[model samples]
Target: MTFWALLILTALLIAAFLGYAMFRGRKNREPAAAYDLRVYREQLAGVDRDLARGVVSEADAERVRTEISRRILAADAQMQAQTDQDGPPLWANVVAISVVAAVLVGGGFWMYRQMGAAGLPDQPLELRKEMAEALRADRPSQAQVEADLPAAPQPQLDESYAALLEQLRETVSARPDDLQGHILLAQHEANAGNFRAAYAAQQRVIELSGDAAPADAYSHLAEMMILSANGYVSPEAEEALKQALQRDPRHGPANYYLGQMMVQVGRPDIGYRIWIDALRVAPPGAPWVEAIYAQLDDLAFRAGVFNPPNIPAPSGPSREDIDAAAALTPEERQEMIQGMVNQLSDRLATEGGPVEDWAQLIAALGVLGEGQRAIDIMKEAVDIFAGDTEALELLDAAAFQAGIAQ
Candidate 1:
């Protein structure tokens, strides 16, 4: 129904309900003077009975009888005056009631209307979905997503580094199917400022890893592409980043570039958010740490973002933990991971955290090969962030990492 029609109907209904109550009250009401006189007469009869039973002194009885008689005479006189004057005037009562009814009904409707949509038509779920889809359609296309990251820092390539790169390349060429060989070649090439070579090796690594490849493979590919192009996030590079995210949403290299992509697309808030999350969860000695911070510091300065001179850095796997884990067997590693996951899961279940935190925990479980635990955590995360698109996207990334989703 239209707003005005509904409002009017509600007001009328309230008015009718109140009017009926008023009418019922009037129908059941007795004449006030008659009722009062009857009550007084009963009191006088009680006093007479008390005096006959000698329950009162004669003097007290006389005084009580006199007071009662006086009150009865006054009531009888008032009743006579009321009869001669006719009944009470009703228009005053009606006018008072009408004003009260109008104030109550109108004021109530006005207050209720203030809290609601008021004049807007109610939108059904289907229409809202269409509108959201249209909005997404208007956003930048896949090709337009750019990283716009700063150029990778370069230092003079020492002779030893050059020799090492050539040696790594020869070793990789000799064993084309060796995944670790390709990965090492890609890393050394990128370190020696041969991003093109790095890109080629990263591609080979992905090829060797095949369909079962994790996000790191694609992430490395994306990074090399950007570095090769002097840090321009091209369409191909963006696609590589997409694939990396498809497998692991919070993959360090991929997220770092993608967040820069958001910045390039004029979404500083998203970039800042993702970068902050990456910074928070990054390993203590991870190579991407400085680069991520460099862009963030610049972005914060440009935007006048107020931050402390030194924000305390996030803690991650300590050296001791790694050393201890390295000493343990694979089965022992599984047990440790399960213990950590249990603690994290219990904490998150009792005291919830942000979307990315949940994603990180799920990713950790997936890395540990705890498929069931990862799935359970994913379900809980989805329930916690239900209907939140950004939250759901983060969760989907975690799920993919966990193999809970394709």
Candidate 2:
């Protein structure tokens, strides 16, 4: 109210001052013709004085007086003409003042509506933090989110595999306290595209392990929960991610999901920081590296980061290798590829490499028509990257190319 009152009052005052100046200027002005008439009359009086003092000849004085009289007549005629043509009417001034006042006040209000925070209250740092906390606390639970989601399409299964999966499920149900049974059930359920069941089984496994459960167990649980919810990080999944981070602060899967949860909860600043730190220390083919790279620009923008660090591309087969392969005959190329694959396999077995090496080996084996070998390597890679969703996805793509079950 005070802001509005001050703005209106200032505008009115300026308009009134301008209108007064216009009227006062006209009133104070002496007409040009009137001034000219007075000067000419003074010259005529000087000519008369000159004649009386005998300072000039009578003819010279008479000629001066006639010229002065003629100038006086012309000046008087101009003054009368000016008086007949008066200044503008008073109503015209009033209308102009009203327009100026309206424009000043109305234009100011329009500009404020476009650019000012007319109604919003100021938000301090503490208030924003409190709002974020409230948002986090109000997120939906896993079950609630899942309930609202559309039913997932069921995968088609061979009769024998279906029977085996059913038998395993029955066995796990019978032996409720068996940790290994629960773990196997979780793995089989997830493989069969039954994520809800998979998470439930994983939860049981964590319960059986109690304090002995590793970060991977909690991370796996979160992964299954998120998948079941179609990529939404529910409150339960966030709790699992928290537990995983509590166990191993550098756990890749946990950190990735934690960042995602922070973004969902309207804390992109924290999410950007978490993802940046994770990417810095992450291996070339760490599961979350690609995901982080994809979202880095948007995350930086939301976090108000104008200049972000460059994200290096993931490592892959060298250009030299491709050129060498291109120069070889078909038989020679096959031999060279096989030799390279064998060397990679040997090196990975002797000293475990990043997940990229394992994926590359699987793909190479598939290209060489060694489907069984590719399948074997994929199984091993899956075990190594159990809780990592992105790594598993890479391995799955390799397996699909190898004509193996995902």
Candidate 3:
């Protein structure tokens, strides 16, 4: 109503201005004959005055007076003829002003209505951000967006698994305090895609373990929720993640999931750091390392990470260096250490060695203050061992001692 009122007011103001201009024009548009008559009268009086002042000869003044008299007669005849006819009615101006006002006001609103969303409240910035994040997550991982893996396939329940699962559920219910039984039931429930059941059983696992409960229970519960929703990170899943991190800040799955969550929630820098840490500590051949390797660099680029330090690969000190270091002179030790470092690095680069050798190189680099080189070695080792848990642990210890991150 207010919008309409403003438009109406604007239209009226414009119409009133136009109408005044039109009326003034009409008033000023006097017959041309009247103007000519006034000019002739002024000229006739001027002729008399000029003659008296001796500015003009009497014969010349007389000739001017005769010509001026002819013009005056013609003007008088024109004015008499004009007065006999009528001019346009006053209503014609009012009609024109009304049409102009209506057209301008109605056209303006019509065009606006055609082009704009009428009466929709604006979305808040936070809500807009959430929407954008959701859209981004739905897109491909590394290819375009954050959700890297294809939606995990929903687990199908086979007849044998289903029968066993039902029997396990009955046993768990009967022996509520049996932690192992509850754990087994929870695992089976998750396998069968019964997420809420899995969630309940995992909760029992946490309850049974009490203060001794590992962070993995909470993290696993979160994973169940996410899988249930086809990778949607809901409030319940987030709460579970919080519990996991609270119990163990560096829990492998917890860190990986939380880091991915950070990426999902538009904190890619935090996400990148989290995933990188997880990748460093994760056992060789872990799934999270692959996901991180495949996706994190792309995420870092998007986050605009400044000065992103050139962290080196993982390598460590060899046993030979350890055995010889105490006996050799400082200069001899330095040369021997350099020789071993060069050999290890060349072998790792050209013909990748065992996990222990990679760890040795990484640790050696760390001791030499080649932190960047150690980090780079670790990055390469993740792929070489990809999922070897034992090798990954060795590299992790070597990286830890060499002060890899520092």
Q: Give the TM-score of candidate 1.
A: 0.37
TM-score of each: 0.37, 0.54, 0.40
lDDT of 2: 0.82
Whole-structure CA lDDT of model 1: 0.73
Candidate 2 residue 313 Cα shift, in angstroms, is: 3.1
Off by over 4 Å in 1: 1-164, 283-406
Q: Which residue ranges in model 2 land beyond 4 Å of their true spot?
A: 1-125, 316-343, 348-406
Candidate 2 has a TM-score of 0.54
State which candidate has the highest TM-score.
2
Per-residue lDDT of model 1, residues 1-406, tens digit only: 5766777677777777877777666667665777878888898888889988999888988898789789888877877776433334567557767887688668877887787666677887667556545643455432343233344566577788777777878887898887767766776777677787788888887787688666766887888887676656666777898998887666788888987766665555567777777777675545577677657777775445777245445455666987999999989988888888788788899998888779878888866767788888888889989999878877875665454564
Point to the candidate with the largest lDDT. Answer: 2
> Which lDDT values do the candidates have, in the order given?
0.73, 0.82, 0.74
lDDT of 2 by residue, 1-406 (tens): 8877887898889888998998897677778888888788888888889889999999999888888888888888878777643577778878988899899889988888787875578988789878888999998888899889888789898899899999999999899998877876887788899999999999998898798676778888999999999888989999899998887687777899889888888889999999888877776656477778778889999888998877567554566976878989999987887888899999998898878678778877866769788988888889999999868766764554343533
Candidate order (lDDT): 2, 3, 1
Looking at candidate 1, what is the lDDT of residue 289?
72
| lDDT measured at residue 326 in model 2 versus the true structure, 0 to 100 | 92
lDDT of 2 at 139: 84
